[model samples]
Target: MIIANISIPLLGMVDTAVMGHLDSAQYLGAVAVGSIIFSFLFWGFGFLRMATTGLVAQAFGRNDTTLSHTILLQSLVLAIIIASAILILKQPLSQLAFLLIDSSEIVSQQARIYFDIRIWSTPAILINYVFLGWLIGKQASKAALVLVLVVTISNMIMDLVFVNVFGMTIDGVALASLIAEYLGLITGLYLLKRHGVTIKLFKRLSSKQVSLFNWHWLQLHANIFIRTLCLMFSFAFFTTQGAKQGDIILAANAVLLNFITLMAFVLDGFANATEVLSGKAVGAKNRSQLKQSLLLTGLWSFVVASLFSLSYLFFGQQLISLMTSITDVQTTANNYLPWLMLMPVVAVWTYLFDGLFIGTTRSIEMRNTMLLSTLCCFLPAWYFLQPLGNHGLWLALLLFLAARGVSQCFYLPRILRMY
Candidate 1:
């Protein structure tokens, strides 16, 4: 699972590498701004996956197969509706995104190009998120792994063909992503069927099922929606601040941010394991197993995060150079390299608790914890530390991650007590 999950970041890293080597720093900044906008757009609805994982894993544990499918069907329908709305609101979305980012005119235009081409991938992307979560919820990780491999490998090859061979630059990258998502979605649907998930979208709904999905479902997912927004905003703010600094810093911070994301996804494999084990425990009402899974996975996640930090602390410059050939960008990225090295250590806590909370369907706690962290800790720290420039940005992010972990500590006893 970890090997396959590596591809998630590898794809983004490759995108950064491609744009970083371009003649203008604007290419990297454009992709950065464009990606941050989508992160806000797509990740805000990330409840589709997280909520599905919790609900489906619980259903599977209880041997309620029909309920799992109900969750899947409703989530997919919601995903399509959201994606369609995004398509209709693309103009206003782009306008608001550029307004927040305030990039160079050239970078803004290029970002628009990437955004215009890539926005259409939302339906496929969201559907695939549901499929991946469902597979993981059922402990069909090998299948989920296969789907990720398909996405990662296909995206890399396409990126090479479209960008390097065809000279499409940023557009090529966007097009590659568009095609890759559809391919992954097809593969996911096939896998879902093979796993005995009926392909019928129009299932007859029972009143009880409708009631379960209506109020309970909306409540569970709405909290996750707010939590995800807070998390996305921290990084979005980082990129916006970086853009304000200048193109080199923006490009440099963009490249470094990939390192942070790469580590997050890599360690997320352990979190995925936590989701499966913990959700199953919750469903079976096995408190001992839930407690045990949390302890064991927390240890594993921490060890793995430390190993990642060690590697980054030592080889960050070399890795940064691999992404961009521009000497100025390279130099500026190295200045911020220490933060990436420390990121895995500080950020792993958030990832672990996130999986635990999601598995237990504790979305309200997740929302409240992040709300407190983002508004109380992150914003205040960043506001006071703004004079420190990019240093301040990295520090603020570190605090955001740390604050998320720390605030959750106060809630851990209550969480465990309830279970």
Candidate 2:
């Protein structure tokens, strides 16, 4: 799981590195802006994955193959509906996204090119999410790893070919992603078949069962959607604020954010394990199993996060230089390396707790805690620390992460009691 999750961010690092080495920072800034827009758009529907994982994990724990299969179909149906809507509304959505973001003219133009091409992959990306969640829920870690590797590795290779070899710019990166997602979707379906998910499972479900849009599912997804939206908003706000500081800061911040993304995805590998194990424990009503799973995953998460911080402390500048050859962007990124070094430990708890909550299907609490963190913690911190420039932005983000973990701690007792 750790190896699989790390590959996810390596794709982004490749994209950044490809653009960062170009003659101008605009290319890097364009990719960053376009990526943020999609993060807001696609990740807003991240409930497709999280909700499916929690629900399917519980079903697997109960040894209910039928219910787990039903959950996957339901998630796929939802993904199709959402993806179709995005395609239909792509034009207005693009306009609205650019309006909300305050990027420079050159960056915005290039970002639009990236967005137009990449938006076509919506269906593949969303369906891939459902497949991933289902695999994780079923404890098919190797299958899940294979699915992710197929997408990310393919994307990375094409990124090099299209950009470096063909000399295509932002469009090449976008095209690579578009092609890779469909490949992933195909691979996901093949894995599902190998894992005993067959067309017969679909045949068995009645019309009412096929339309699994029940009140409970809707309510669960609504809470997770809100939670994910708030999370995306924070990152989007961070990116927009950096853009306001000019292209150098925007490009430099983009480079640094790859570090944060890499750390988050690595920690999330443990969290993914926690989600499956914790969900199974809940379904089985085994308190000891739940506690043991959390303890082990929590310990490993901290250890890994600490390693990230140490690596950054000792080799941060070299990493910055490696990502971008531009001396100005490298120097600017180096100036903020300390904040990157501090992020892993401070943010690790949020990833751990997020896993616990998702595994248990505690969406309402997740929703409320995220609201508190974003509204009460992050926004307020950024407001007051405006004098600190980019340091203030990084601090606000850190406070947001800390607030989420701390706030989530208060809910553990209630969650355990309910179980």
Candidate 3:
């Protein structure tokens, strides 16, 4: 599961590498802005996958085969519905996102091209999200790994053929991604048939056996919705602020953001593991196992995060240079690299607890705490940094992560005590 999750981001890294070779710095910056916008716009609905996996895993644990199938079906239905909505709103969303990002006109136009082509992949992308979560819930981690690996390899190959061989540029990258996602969705469905289906599971697929409006399921999903929304907005706001500073600043921030994303992808392995184990425990009403999972995952998170921090502390500048060659962007990114180094150390607990909370379907508290913290901690820090220029922006983000970690700490004990 972790390998699967990490592949998604590494594919983005590969895309970055391809774009880095383009003749102009503007292309690199355009992909950065375009990706950040879509990341928030699309993956923000990630709650569907997280919620489904937790619910399905718990249902599986309790031997409630019918409920597990219902969860999977509902997740696909929701993904399709949401993807359609994004399609209708794509133009306005693009306009709004670009307006707020405040990049150079050329970069903005390039981003729009990427956004337009990429928007069509929404349905396939969201369906894959459901498929992935279901696979994880079923403990078919190897299948998930294969699905992502195939998609990543296919995407990289397409990127090379379209961008390098054919000179299709950013649009080529977007098209490559779209093609890869549909291929992945098809692959996922085949895997589901080969590895997931059974006589017992088929019996639960009948319409009469499933409820469309499960209150508990809806409530769990809604909480995650709120949580995901707040999280997306925070990053969106961060990008918008960077954009407002001009392209050099935006490009610098983009380089730094990729590093942050790389760290998140690596740590996500531990968190994704917790999601499976913790959700299964909660589903079985095995409270002790849930507690144990959290403790073990927390220990793992700290160790992994410490290693990441050390890597960044020592080689941050060198890594930033590897991502881009523009002198101004490189210098600006190096200035902000320290924040990325601090991020893993401060936010690892928050990431682990997030998986635990999602698994236990304890999302309302998660949402509420995040909402409050974003307004109280993230906003104030950003507002205070207004006078400090770019340094201030980095400081605000640092505080934002720190605040989330601190808030999670205070709230976690209460939930643990309740368990």
Candidate 4:
């Protein structure tokens, strides 16, 4: 499960690797902007995965096969509905996001090309989320790993073929990702069949059961929706602000942020494991197991975060050089390189604690913490510090992470003791 979850972010790294080699900074910036837009849009709804996994895991733990099946069914139905809605709103949303970023006309135009093409993958991406969530609930980590690897490898290969071989630019990258997602969906259905689970588990659902399912599912997802929206807004704000400054700054920040996101994806392996193990423990009502899972996961997150920070500190410039030889982009990125080094150290606890809370299904606290972090901490800090320019933006983001971690930490004792 951890491996599968971590691969989600690493896939982004693969895309970065491809675009980083593009000769123009505009191409690199376009991919970065386009990716972030979708990251927030698609991943914003990732509660489908987190919530579905926890609920389904709990059902599986209790040996309620029917409930598990119903959860899966309803989740799929909801994902399809959401995906369609996103399609309906696609044009406006794309325009809004492009406008927010304030990039050069060339960069924005390229990003829009990618966004328009990739928006069609919403259904595939959402369905895959539900399928993966179901696999995690069934404790089929190996299968989940296989699913992610297939998607990542397929996407990477297509990215190269489309971009380098066929001379497709942003649209090619977008098409590769969209096609890979659909391929993953098809493969997921095939694998689900091989598992040979009883369809009875998915049936015998009553209207009342359906109603309860919808209510609880919406409750859980609503909280996550708000949380993810705020988180995405921060990234959007950062990129948008940087774009307004100039294309070079936007391009530089984009490159640096990709490295930061890559490290995050790697560290998320531990967080993902924590989520799976902790949810299982909660389902079994095994208090000791839950504590052990959380402790070990936090320790693991620290180790990975430390290693990434050290790597960036020692080899940061060389790594940037490899990503792009653009002297101006590299020089500007170096100025902000320190933030990447500090990101994991400052943010590791927040990510780990998130896994813990999600596992235990204490989502209201999770939602509230994010609300407070964004509204009380981040926005206020950004408003006050905008005078300092980009430093203010980075500082606000760092504070948002710190505030989230602190809020979760303060609530942990009460949350754990209640159980």
Q: List model 4 lDDT by residue over 230-309, tens digit each.
A: 88888888888888788778888888887777777666667667777877787788888888888888888898889889
* Top TM-score model: 2
Off by over 4 Å in 4: 197-212
lDDT of 1 by residue, 259-366 (tens): 888888977887888888889998899989899999999999999999989999889999999999999999999998888888999999988998899899998899
Task: Name the best candidate (by lDDT).
Answer: 2
How would the candidate models be sorted by TM-score, starting from the highest?
Answer: 2, 1, 3, 4
lDDT per residue (tens digit) for residues 81-199 in model 3? 88999999888998888878878889988999999998898998888888888888888889889888888999999999999899899999999998998899889888888865654
Candidate 4 worst ten-residue window by lDDT? 199-208
Clash statistics: count for each candidate = 0, 0, 1, 0
User: Which regions of candidate 3 fall more than 4 Å away from where they truly are?
Assistant: 198-204
lDDT of 3 at 217: 77
Looking at model 3, how many pairs of residues clash?
1
Give lDDT: candidate 1, residue 264: 89
Q: What lDDT does candidate 3 reach at residue 91? A: 83
lDDT values for all models? 0.89, 0.94, 0.82, 0.82
Candidate 3 lowest-lDDT run of ten: 198-207
